[model samples]
Target: MYIPELYKNENAEEIKSFIKTNSFGILVNQTQGKLWGTHIPLELETNLQGKEVLFGHISKENPQGESFTDNNEVLSIFNGPHSYISSSWYDHENVPTWNYIAVHVYGKIRIIEGEELLFAMKKLVDKYEATSKNPVKIENLSAETMRQINGITAFEIEITDIQAVHKLSQNRDDKNHNTIISELEERKDNNSQAIADAMKKQRS
Candidate 1:
């Protein structure tokens, strides 16, 4: 990612938290002269050895998985809050811009099959299903159904490089920043709320 100095975020902890908050992201890979991408919620973790790992699974029938063969690399992009800022909202002659947070992680693909797939399934279920109104118990599902679901591909990305950016009006002076924040707060949209939150965090 080519991020301007004004929008760049160098803190790893901040970027990691942003990724966790917005866990659903795009996993992109290429194979057979074609590009493929999968949009799914991924589980991110740091092991005892202090290495970052990304875990996710895809349907067996999904062609995106085929792109992640033995040695193919992959790029996973985590996009957080984003809102369009009109130049009219600012007090100066600044052109329109976007306020957003995003992280790009590049790594090698390691496919996990058979028992490993089952382990990945359990991990996913434990992470997402536990918070539901009527929590889904994977153990409650029939053995055959579980087996069928386990047929999906499970993979992990051992991230080699990571870059993140937080463009939350940090480049503007206090006056302009406050103006954009107030204008965004008046909008009844999720992105606007996020921009407001980011602005508050940055100012703090």
Candidate 2:
């Protein structure tokens, strides 16, 4: 994550909040001279020391879970909306670019099992289902279903480092930035709309 000083976001709380909103991320690691990656939705938690820890799980059948041994170093990437910024939107001559939000978390992995895995599952379900009209509850799950869910290999990572970038055309002048936002807002795509919103928030 080569974030320039101009685009770097140093706010720790903001970065954590971004990860919570975009909980689905790619977990990357290496083993046996090969690279492996798995897409998983993670839950964030804090230790008694107030340090951030990440919780997530992968199928026991997934070789990535087996690779979690040895306290291997792992990287999780959380990506937000992004869109192309056409040079045509700029007042003067310039090359095209992109605007987006991303966070990289590096940590040491440890596998968790038994009641801890069940607890993680309940937390995840409650978080995502909170906004639904018919929210799901852990008690609603049958014993067999809960056992099946527990079969997955849950893991926790005590995050050692974090890097975040919010590249929302901050390098451009006010006029150019506003122009890009306007054009993006007019576009029907969700990514463009999201970029526009992020740019507007940055401006504020």
Which candidate tops lDDT? 2
Tens-place lDDT per residue, model 2, 89-180, is 99999899999999999999888776666666777898888999999898798888777875588888879899999999998999999999
Question: Which tens-of-lDDT digit does each residue in 1-204 have in candidate 1?
Answer: 998887888888888888878889999888566777789977787533466688888888888777777446998999887999999977767689888889998988888766655666676787788788988776688988776765678887888988898889887888888998899999979999988998989888
Per-candidate TM vs. native? Answer: 0.90, 0.93
Would you list the C-alpha lDDT of every candidate in the order shown?
0.82, 0.87
Off by over 4 Å in 2: 47-51
Instruction: Name the weakest run of 10 consecutive residues (lDDT summed) in model 2.
Output: 43-52
State model 1's lDDT.
0.82
Worst 10 residues of 1 by lDDT: 43-52
Q: State candidate 1's TM-score.
A: 0.90
